[model samples]
Target: MNDKREVFYAKIMLFGEYSVICDSMGLTIPYAHFKGELSFINEDKYTDLEFAYESNRQLKKYSLYLQKLIDDGELIFEFDLSSFKKDIDKGLYFESSIPQGFGIGSSGALCAALYNEYGQNKIPNSRHISKKEILNLKKIFAQLESYFHGVSSGIDPLNCYLKHPIIIQGKADLSTVGIPRNKHDEKGAIFLINTGHAGMTEPLVKLFFEQCKQHSFYKSIRDEMIPFNNNCIKSLIKGETKEFFKNLRGLSKFLLKNMEPMIPETFKEIWNIGLDTSTYYLKLCGSGGGGFLLGFTEDLEKAKFELKKHNVELIPVYKNAKVIDTIKNI
Candidate 1:
């Protein structure tokens, strides 16, 4: 049996897909939808034992790889796997509700939970770390998670590590930021519309990379995406939300026109309707295929009405119109 520890949930980046790779602005939050906690179990809990066995089977393989990195001097912090293996045998599986491949950081949450409970150095929450230290931590976490999604953003793991809203400006340029507050009950809110199918990040990202190899597509991404992402950040920062949506709409169209095949065939009509009707602006939440689609609207009711015909699951993001706070008391 081990001590109890709470693991925080992770949210999705509503925008900034491939664009974020090119030094574009990206934003993310910690969704409180699900969480996991560490707890002791009697040796008699066979079900927990079984789950732990399977999880250990997966984690051990990664630990071996991490050990190799440590041996090669590539990784600094090295965890003791012996006790962790023993704990797994004693029933230490994660009891979590975060759904995988749903644009939410399920694997990332698990990685954070494991690191918090078992890592060697264990970054301190009470003590502030340098930006370089934070990025180094992120790189280590990302290395631990490369097995899940071929290439790791390291952002998801970093968010899970920090358990806070993060703003990404470019490669190696990230910092914790506050969520804008909304107090006026403004109908305009960011939302998630479920497309009813799970998305595979690897394949979708692979496709985008292949597309990037093309000269014309590469130019559009450089010229269009980079500018739109910067503008969107500026607008949101300056409280010019109207301009934010306008740029979002533009960015959405650019994705539609250039990244056509990435949009699922079934949802193309609904995707068009959003742009055509001006009801809401739809964009990929994360490697979109059949997972949750991000929507931006000034009128939630109208967006709901316009989107009623489609079997889309709408999730309210922010309401009541307030700027996002960067720091919050624990």
Candidate 2:
């Protein structure tokens, strides 16, 4: 029972939200600030036995779900169910800081940790991993994570498992990519604006799929959003700051108009403020029912000043030089 795995971090989809469904390029990065791990509670030092008990109960339920999948031969990979059951009986639970339903890959981290610790014939994270292997891993994760999202692209868990930036060129093409380096003294930043509520990815994604059935909606996405999203990915990857911001603004505007249902009602005014003043631009962080809204600005201080009236937390994607250095090393 000593086979503990490293913590799995949450991931951010920097570009391509629903557009990815239509074969648009998407970029995702591992956000190490929020993470999760599998561990057992020490009942001796713990006062809250109820919390531990509940967590263990939840794990038992999840174990049953996995067992059902295995029994039905619906899962492609094998899991050490005996060991997993033993751990669950010993009160093993996923200890996580990543907020569930916050659009930050909480379920993805759990899936990654589970596969890493319990899956047999696991795929190792390395540069040498073939594209075929990566796609297989993604498929495995997509099936496992469907328990949470109803449907999944599997990119989130794949990114968490690899702990590397991933570029999804289309439905069938994905690869690890190095993010362009950030300047130390740069004032520009990408940030998350808390919406103060958790969002259900299933419903939002379902809504998106339904909307896509409409010819006009599908055309707008294919003609407008996909291009903007792809351009943003290309510009960001190339470190073309001016072009990146330009495409980002266009994407921001397009989302505000077409993706209105995804935006929280409370943040609508502030979202418009960014477009009206050009101080900052906002986009959906993930499925975006009510979780975090992603923001980009050339001047962090100025964006903060403009957003002061909104009672929301502003979390800079990269807060300091140390973070940049750490990412570079990764």
Candidate 3:
């Protein structure tokens, strides 16, 4: 059954969280630091027997779900489910480092691996994939990922599958984008602050949709959050640092005030501190009930100093020596 497949990496939604649902511009990039691949374990050679057993069990469950989708004619794509089941019987499972319940695309990476290995008439990865093809692929991924998120936008899997930076312009418009090159001596950085807890995206998103039922809440999102979010994406892509920071500050403030529930209670004070001092800005990475909180700071060292007592790890998305060296060449 050949269960081995190329690894699919996790993704970070750099901008546009809830706003993307309403057709605002969103930017996402593949985070190769964490990834997953489908593999079969030989019980004699595997050390973690319980983990292997559990993973195989989960994959069997997922296969059943896929079979149901196939039977109902709900899934538009074709895959060799018979072979997939054969592999599952052989202890096939996803081996991944991507943490679940984080804003990062854990399930999305799994869906991508499945589709990459099994999908019929698969969309080839290329710079030339058409808008229509991309949208169609997104729909397929959305349905596939629904097993995890309850509701799926499919953008996560799309980004993971393509392994490229994606800019979502609207509900159906997405394109590959090249991020602006970092300066060799850049002081600013993007980072993730671990909340030390996982978040369930379905509940958080459900709460958001329920809140949107209110006129004022819906209007505020339309009038303030969407505009700020869209502007931030635009400014960032254009490498307009001043404009980007200005819009980021506004977006950060809006989220702090309006999306309070999404932010972790323990981290709320730090989130506010960032806004109050202009030292840093914190925003929702994803559904944000308790996963990783994304941060932006003009000075990474200053942010670290301010956040040191919090006991949370700060993982820099940029500003690493290797990244700086790559930027220098670029």
Candidate 4:
């Protein structure tokens, strides 16, 4: 406990943006390229004092809320407020690289790091944590993170907490499954398309919920959107690579057509072009005001050519790993 410990980076849903809410499957992987660390600091050198002070101020407010919950018997464990207060006074803060609203779970990582470092209930071995407990923990973390974003799925924090690949079957059914083998030879791939603007997920998600008030939108989502999402998940899980991308194309189109207003105006034309060109299909990765737009392509080379005009930054993630059997069992 004396040594400083760092939590590894968390890779979020390679797919399943909003579809997962209604029970569509979600796939997540852990990426080590970005991460956060927790440490005990000696109050001597103060370089980024201003930033630290602001972060501490925010953390203090959250901690007080948590303390209140514990006092009301809502939370099960007692929190060590004295030590937490001292750390805050010394300018303690979460140091992170995970981007917010890019859908990689930056806030989730922070919550996980804090829970790991400060939560009184000891982390029993991961093996000892039951499925129910896992879900419950995710729920708790999600609630904690709602302070940042109005509503949270908790999947981000859950992935950060577990630091492993997790698959969601539906709202109530979630489990960890093995990933299929990644075919390095396949020219087909999935990628992140930089939208050149940072998106605010809370606002976008709120808009979606507001739109859901309309019966037509709600019905379309339940009928068209959810089915497309489920099929995409199935195709991907079953190693049906061709079918997976095909379904993604359908999903991208559906979103563009039905969820047009949700997409930022800047990305509208490009999104439509991708669909019409049939070279690549673009969909919202998270809430999508800006940030990264998810894309699927049958031929990466052609997709590159078609997208060259946009000058978008294409980041490859699951180049080789496309299906379910590729990952090792838990």
lDDT values for all models: 0.72, 0.85, 0.84, 0.71
Using Cα atoms with residue i matched to residue i, what is each candidate's TM-score against the true structure?
A: 0.88, 0.94, 0.94, 0.87
Model 3: residues with Cα > 4 Å off, grouped in runs: 1-4, 43-47, 183-185, 320-330
Model 2 TM-score?
Answer: 0.94
- Residue 189 in candidate 2 has what lDDT? 80
lDDT of 1 by residue, 238-310 (tens): 6677788889889888878887766778888888899999988888877777677788887888898888877
Better of 2 and 4 by TM-score: 2
In terms of TM-score, which candidate is strongest? 2
lDDT of 3 by residue, 39-65 (tens): 778734444667768889998999999
- Model 3, residue pairs in steric clash: none
Model 2 clash pairs are none
After superposition, candidate 1 runs with Cα above 4 Å error: 37-57, 67-73, 126-129, 183-185, 320-330
RMSD of each: 3.0, 2.0, 2.4, 3.1
Show the lowest summed lDDT stretch of 10 residues, model 4: 321-330
Error at 137, model 4, angstroms: 1.5
- Error in Å for residue 209 of model 1: 1.8
